[model samples]
Target: MNSRFRRRSLLNSSEDNDPMSVVSNLFDVAMVFAVALMVALVSRYNMTEMFSQEDFTMVKNPGKENMEIITKEGEKISRYTPSGNKDSSSGKGKRVGVAYELENGDIIYVPE
Candidate 1:
């Protein structure tokens, strides 16, 4: 009598058909998916940090050259002079007041 005949697998007819191989293959697939997910998360995080503009400053005034007004939020608003004073619809006079509108619809004007 052979030992192979005496020993039998509960689910398979022969030792060659061991179910552990299937379990190992599943584990390998799961590991690969886990690694892929981790890499994707890291890449997404890096991309978000690269292109995000939340930390950048904004320019408030585009046409002005000599004067720059930096807001509380770090935005730089600029005002410039035309070498010769030309009268236009836009006031050429000095800034008389600076005002900010609040969320409650109230305007707060800074004393000049």
Candidate 2:
């Protein structure tokens, strides 16, 4: 046999019928799949953060005396403070109402 043919035959015989070669190729394919999945997940997370509605909506800032006041309907924002109290306390001092908490995790408050 020619030297070139002999060399090719020798090199090919080492791996041609080896089960380890198939396993190595499978492992390489699995690694590629895992890498692709990670890349996709990262891209999806970035896209969710970019397109989320929280970006468009305004967050309520810390207002007078721990009051969680928000005005949604009015274009021009207005703040109204009930006379005498300034610490913005809740409970019976919270609103113009008597609040009752029910057994089903619901709150019912009636204005005074």
Candidate 3:
């Protein structure tokens, strides 16, 4: 047999099938799956704005006692929560509109 053929056969031999190579392939597939899952979750919840450089404001658990307001402006982020006092009103702003939450969690605003 030729030397080049011998070397090619040696490289293609069953004995060269290392178990570690299988593990490496599995690890690569797992990394791809993890990245895909992260992208799906970000798009599912409309959370792409959280990763952008533009200003955005998001409300979590709206109309609940544990509601949270997250605002991002420039490179700064701020979170606001209620003080748990239901009887206090401090702002001088007038009520220009009324908002009603429907059964499907959609809000409708009606101007005064």
Model 1 worst lDDT window (10 residues):
69-78
lDDT of 3: 0.92
Give Cα distance to truth, residue 89, candidate 1, Å: 48
Q: Quantify all predictions' global Cα lDDT against the true fold.
A: 0.61, 0.63, 0.92
TM-score list, all predictions: 0.29, 0.33, 0.58
Q: Write the per-residue lDDT of candidate 2 for residues 1-112, one digit (tens) a residue.
A: 6999999888889668788989999999999999999879879755333333342222334454544443334344444443446365545444567889999999998889
Misplaced by over 4 Å in model 3 are 1-16, 83-112
Clashes of each: 3, 0, 0
Q: Which sections of candidate 2 miss by over 4 Å?
A: 1-12, 47-112
Tens-place lDDT per residue, model 3, 1-112, is 6999999998999856787988888999999999999999999999898889999999999999999999999989899998798657657578899999999999999999
Residues 1-112, model 1: lDDT tens digits: 4666556444456666787988998999999999999879879755333234344333334566543432232343333334434556357568878999999999999978
Number of the top TM-score candidate: 3
lDDT of 3 at 106: 100
Instruction: Put the candidates in TM-score order, highest first.
Output: 3, 2, 1
RMSD of each: 14.1, 12.6, 6.8
Off by over 4 Å in 1: 1-16, 47-112
